[model samples]
Target: MENKMNRRGFFAAMGKFMGLAAVAPAVLGGVFSNQANAQEKRRSAGPGASAVAGSMVDVNDPIAKAVKYVEDFQKSPASKGNKCATCGFYAKKEMHGATEVGTCTIFAGKLVNANGFCASWNKKA
Candidate 1:
């Protein structure tokens, strides 16, 4: 009877441990998903999205002359030269309402039209 009791106790402990182990991943996944959702919500609710959307400039605007310069340069003998991807002002991913535009760090509130170029263009170090 003592031996049977010991075996039952061992099995009970293992069952409890296995149950907790199975639940651990689900619990962690829930926590991470919640955190990601919160961050996304915060970003969409903030000024960054609104600011970019409202301040977007036309690709043909004179203010976007630099954008044109980059395009022209790309076709010239300097085709191998600088590009938005290599520039400091280039925003790799689209944000806010500037889907085709790259956010220029130097332009502050303004996002550079992806097709736009500027004198501030620099090669990525």
Candidate 2:
């Protein structure tokens, strides 16, 4: 009787292991495909586009001060034609007339004001 119980236990463990092995490939494949899709989106968005979400830059940051970044574009003298949305380094997507917040290449993935400008501003052609 004991021998029979041990055999049943062994078979149950084996079944579970087989099930996991079979599902692993599918799970891994999904992850890889999702990553590939994200990469393609970034590439299509142009040079400064990155797949990772970025943090908003602090106004007190040294770089911000050096670049003369202003949170509100209306407050800056150079805001006329150098807003982030119009800059060469801005990476964002606009949907349904709504502009998404974007990251700037100058800040190396840090989020910037869409209507903001910096010393590195290059007008988007």
Candidate 3:
């Protein structure tokens, strides 16, 4: 009878611990998520920049379609050493302060694909 009582107490303690373990990740994720967002904001800076962060340039946009914009650099005819990142119109310094993606003077406030290509691409001078 005493052993039965001890086993019940142990099971209760373990149940409480398991519940806490499950809730800890959610609580911590919420706490750290804000910090991560703040860091992202710092990285995304440009005109209409709020909407550009983590967004890919739409290939169907008029200019993109007209220019035959290809999202993947490798698939583009300009694949060899050509990409928005190295293009003259790419505003690498003005948007996001990162080269992984940026705005294009041609796109005007819209995010351009980093590994993308277009007919307007010119060698960065």
- Estimated TM-score per prediction? 0.39, 0.57, 0.51
By summed lDDT, the worst window of 10 consecutive residues in model 1 runs over: 45-54
Per-residue CA lDDT of candidate 1, range 1-125, in tens? 99999999999999999999999999999999999997886575445333443365554667566544444345544445656656765664454453465556755555555644556677766
Worst 10 residues of 3 by lDDT: 46-55
lDDT of each: 0.62, 0.77, 0.75
What lDDT, from 0 to 1, does candidate 1 have? 0.62
Separate clash counts for every candidate: 3, 0, 0
Candidate 3, 67-91: lDDT as tens digits = 8888777887656758888888876
Rank list by TM-score: 2, 3, 1
lDDT of 2 by residue, 39-114 (tens): 7876776655555545677879999999888877778877775688888888774332344567787777577778
TM-score (C-alpha) between model 1 and the true structure = 0.39
Residue 123's lDDT in candidate 2: 80
Model 2, residue 69: distance off in Å is 0.4
How many clashes would you count in candidate 1?
3
Could you report the Cα RMSD, in angstroms, for every candidate shown? 10.2, 4.3, 7.5
lDDT of 2: 0.77
